[model samples]
Target: MNDYVRGSAWRVPVTACQPRPLSAFLSRNAQRRPASAIRSLLPLEQEPGMISLLAGKPNPATFPIEEIAVKVRLPDDASSPVVVAVTGDRLQKALQYGPTAGTPALVDWLAQLTSSLHGRPLPAQSSDSTKPWQLAVGNGSQDLIVKAFEVILDSGDTALLQSPTYPGVLPALCVGQVNTVAVESDEAGIRADALERMLARWDVDEKTSSLARPKLLYMVPTASNPTGTSTSLDRKRALLRLARKYDFLLFEDDPYYHLSFEEATPSLFALDGQDSDHDQGRVLRFESLSKVMSAGLRIGFVAGPSVLVDAINKYTATSHLQVSGVSQCVAIAVLEQMGHRGFLQHAARTADFYRRRRDAFERIAHEILRAEPPVAEWTSPGGGMFLWLRLLLPLNANTAEGDSFALISTQARRAGVLAVPGVAFLASSGGTSTYVRVSFSLIGEEDTAEAFRRLRRVILDL
Candidate 1:
C-alpha cells in the first residue's frame, strides 16, 4: 500500500485494480426490476407539435387553485418580504404526475447548485457507455439514504458505520438485517487509525474473521447527529483514501452540510473530483433542503457517479414514484428567487442562528453541569442543532462506562426535559453509553437555559 502525507491536499494513488461493472454491485432484486410503463411514455409528451393522449395524468384546468404564492422572508430585511409566485405553466407541471427522476426544472436547478457548491463540474453530455457524475432529487435525504442502501446491500451484507451515528438509518438497517460494524470515533469524528486497524486486520482478526468485509461506509461528516462532531478536512481526505484502498463506496449523509459555524471543509464528493486518477465513483453525497428551507417540503438530492444514481432512481421509480411534484416546484421557486449567492447567504444566517443557540445552551451547561467536580463534559459543536453531553456517572460493574438510558428516558422526562439517550445512536447491539443528545434547535430561547437546569437537577438527584 502507498502512503500519502498527512494534512496535505494531495491525492494518493489507489491500488491498480480494474473498475468493476455497475451491475456487479447491485442487489439481486434490483437486477430484475423493470422500468415503469407510464414513465417510459413521458418522453413522447416532450416532442414539439405532438398533441397526444398519454397516461392518466390529470388536467391542470380542472384543478381548484388559480395560483400559489409563497412569501419568502429575507434574512437581511424582516419587513421587506419577497413573494414568489408559482402559477400558470409552473403550477400546472407541479399538480400533475411527473417523471420518476423528479421535476426537470428543479432537477436541473439543483444539479447546477450542487455542482457549483461542491466545485465539481457537471459531466458533459456524451454518448460514452460509462456513466459520469450527476444528481437525483428525493423525498428527503432520509428517503435517498434508504434507497441508496437498497441499491447496494443484500441481506447479510456488512456495512461499516461511525459509532454514535444518526438513529434514522438504524431502523432501515435493522429491517434489512445488514451486518453493521461500529468504527471507533474521537472528538474529530471517526478516528483514522482505528478504521485503518479494522480494515488492515479484517480477514485475520478473530473478531471479524467470521464476517465479510464491509461494502459500504455510512457517515454523517458534518455535525454528526448524536455526537455533533465535525470531521476535519485532513480526516476526510484520509477516509477517502481508505475507501479507494479498500474499494468500498462511501455514503456521505451530509444534511447539515450548510449548518457549519466555521469554514466548511471540502466534502468527499468534492475531493473525489479533485483527484486526476479518480472518476468520482467513491462517494455518494446526500444533501437536503430540509435543514435550510422547509423539512415539510421533503426535498433532497444525491450527487455522485451516475451508475449509483441510476440504481437509486430505479428503486425510487417503484417506491415513491418521485418526490412530491408540488414540493419540487416550491423548492425550485425558492432556490431561483434566492439565486446561488442569496441561498448561501441564507445558509450563513442559519449557521449563525444555531451558533448563538449553541453559545446560550453551553453557557448554561457550564454554569449548571460543569461546576465542582464537573458532572458532565462535552465538545462544543461547530455546527448543527445538537449538543452531545457525556455524564461522569458512576461506572457500572459490567460495563466500563455508565449508562444514560435510564437517566434520559426516565429521570430527564420526569424532570420535564427530554433528550435522546446516547445508546440509541450506537451502531452495534448491546452497546452502552454515558452520553445523551440534546437539541438546541426547537427549544424556545427562554427555555434553553432552564432545560439544562432541569437536566442537571435530574442528574444530581440520581
Candidate 2:
C-alpha cells in the first residue's frame, strides 16, 4: 500500500507526451503472448512484387458470393435510398480471409476519424520509445474491453469502475478473478472529488487496504448506461488529473459517444494529459458503431497506445481473429459514400431522433410518476437512451431505501412492462439500490404515455 506519486514532483511542460514504459502496464501473460505464425507473416504479403508462398489463403475461384450490394438510407429522412456496392478487389477481400487487426481500409478510416474528431495526429509510428497511439478494430467494444482487462490485470490486481456500470461488462471482469471495486457515481458519471479522496486514503480504507492498487479505471463517460448522465468537459479534466496522479489508465467504454443530445464532450482520450501537461497513454478509448450503425454488424474499436492495441490484436488473433470482413466492407463502403462530414452529419441526425424520444418519454414520465406523493424521480438525461428513475419504496431491513430487484423483475414484469433492476448493474454483494433503468430507444411515441402509466401502477402497487 504505497502512494501513486513519485517524489511529490508531478508536472511536465505542455509538449508531446513521453510514452510510459510498456513494462509499467502489461501483464505477465501479455508479455509472454506469442505471435501468431501465419498472422505475423500476413503483413509481409503486401510488399511490392514480393512473390512468396507465405500464406495458405484459399483461391477465390473455389468460393461463392461474387458481389455485395447494400441498400443504404440517407441521413435526411426525406432523401431517397441509395445502393452501395462492393465489387472486384474489394469484394474479393471481403469474401477472403483478411488481416488479424482488421481490413486495412476500415481500420485506417477509423484512425482518420479519431484523428479528425479527437484532434490527434494519425497513428504515430516511430523508432523511438514513444509507443505510437493507434486504433484496433474489434467485433464490438465489449470484445476489446474484456480482452483489455485480461492484458493489463492479473488475478489479485484491482480495477476501479464507476458503480452502476453497464452490467454486460461485469462477467468479463469477474472471469479474470480481478478485484473490481466500485467508486460511487453521481448524476454526472464518476464523482472525481470522491475518487481523489478515496485514492488518497487507499492504504487506510478498509475495502481497499488489503488489495492491489488499481491498474485501470472503467467509465462510460458519455451517456453512462444505467445512469443516462454525461460527464462535463471540466469534470473530464479533473478525472484525467486523477489518472495521471494515480498511474492508472482510464478504460472509456463509450458506446454512447455519438448519441449525445448536445455537442459531444471531449473524451478522456482527447484530454489524456491536458491537466498534467503530459499524455503518457493513460486513456484506452473503446468506441462502438453498434449504437449509430447496425448492432448486428458488431463493429467497434479500441483507440489507444499501440502497446496495448498490439496485445489486443494478439488476443484477437487467438480468439475471434477479426471483426467480419464482410461487415467491415459494408461499413467502409457506406462510410466512403458519406465521407467524414456526411458520416458525422448522419450521426447528428441519429442523435436528434433519440433526443426527441428522450424528451417525450421524460415528459410523460414526470406527469404520472411525480403526482401527489411521488412514486419516483430522476434527472433528465443529457445524452444516451435511458431514463434512470429512483423508485421510492418502503424501507426494508437490509436497505434503508428498498431494493428494485424484486419489484422491477416481478411486479413490473406482471404489469407487462419491464426494466432492468439496479442490482444487476452493481458488482458488490447484496446488490441493493432504489434505481431501475428504462430505455426510450425503441418504443413508439404513441405508446410512450401508456408505458409510464403501467410503470406507475407497478411502483404504486409496491
Candidate of highest lDDT:
1
**TM-score of each predicted structure versus truth:** 0.94, 0.93
Model 2 steric clash pairs: none
- The list of candidate 1 runs beyond 4 A from truth reads 1-16, 49-51, 126-131
Model 1 per-residue lDDT tens digits across residues 82-187: 9988998888888888877788888888888888878988667663235478788899999999988877877777788998888899888888878898988778
Q: In model 2, which regions exceed 4 Å deviation?
A: 1-20, 76-78, 125-131, 273-277
For candidate 1, the lDDT comes to 0.82
Top TM-score hit: 1
All-Cα superposition RMSD per candidate: 5.0, 4.2
Report lDDT per candidate: 0.82, 0.81
lDDT of 1 at 78: 54
